[model samples]
Target: MQARYYTLNEARAALPVVKALMSQVQEARSEILRLRPEIWPVLQKAAHNGGNAAAGSVYSQFDKLETGVKGILKMGILVKDIDMGLIDFLSIRNGREVYLCWKHGEEDLSFWHDVNAGFGGRQPIDPEDF
Candidate 1:
């Protein structure tokens, strides 16, 4: 699918919904990590011996994680890091695509960076630039 670009105002307006979704993504990610070790053992057991009953719960957690991530991507927002809760919105700046960078815990979307630059390259958004 073609990428969707958000105007500055639109990006800012979407923050609340984005924040909520990111929270779900973060929770799902943490649960997945916590279940990883258990999941592998269960899978190994199932491989050798018919099936492991515990595998269903582990797979359910993975399904939720995948669904949450797909929901975010479907909105045209990039999930940069689940642990960091970092996300970006595609936007146009100076006639080219850039990222409106945001991380969890921030009160607002106040930074942006070039397409090739990551979080370290973020610059404060100038009110006039929008």
Candidate 2:
């Protein structure tokens, strides 16, 4: 993970894709939460082993989808900056900060990392995954 900065236009151009990915992330989150009641105990059991095995699976999927979307957009995203995080735009639904991952390509915004980790660590997105 490296710090890849982005220009405003580059960030804006990828908005649609970012929005779509955000939608998936939200859906994954919703699904995780919806299933939490049934998942909690299993997750708790796994936590006993010092690992969030149960929840980790779901969370990994969520993170994958989230990162996948960010990667497609080729943006270095920080939902929040040195001061805040995604919480600031939580109410806006679809709002995300995709910083620049690279400077060019159809996959210009070819990767996305996390708010905490920033753009330096974007994982590739397989076209088939979309």
lDDT: which candidate is best?
1
TM-score of each: 0.84, 0.43
Shift in Å, residue 59, candidate 1: 1.8
Off by over 4 Å in 2: 46-74, 81-130
Tell me the lDDT of model 1 at 121: 99
Give the 10-residue window scoring lowest on summed lDDT in candidate 2.
Answer: 84-93
| Residue-wise C-alpha lDDT for candidate 1, range 1-130, written one tens digit per residue | 2357988889889888888877777777777677778778767766646545456665676677677777778888898887898989999888888999999889999999999999999999986776
Looking at model 2, residue 72 earns an lDDT score of 45
Candidate 2 local distance difference test against the native:
0.47
Instruction: Output the lDDT of residue 78, model 1.
Output: 90
What is the C-alpha RMSD, rounded to one decimal, of candidate 1?
2.2
Model 1, position 100, has a per-residue lDDT of 94
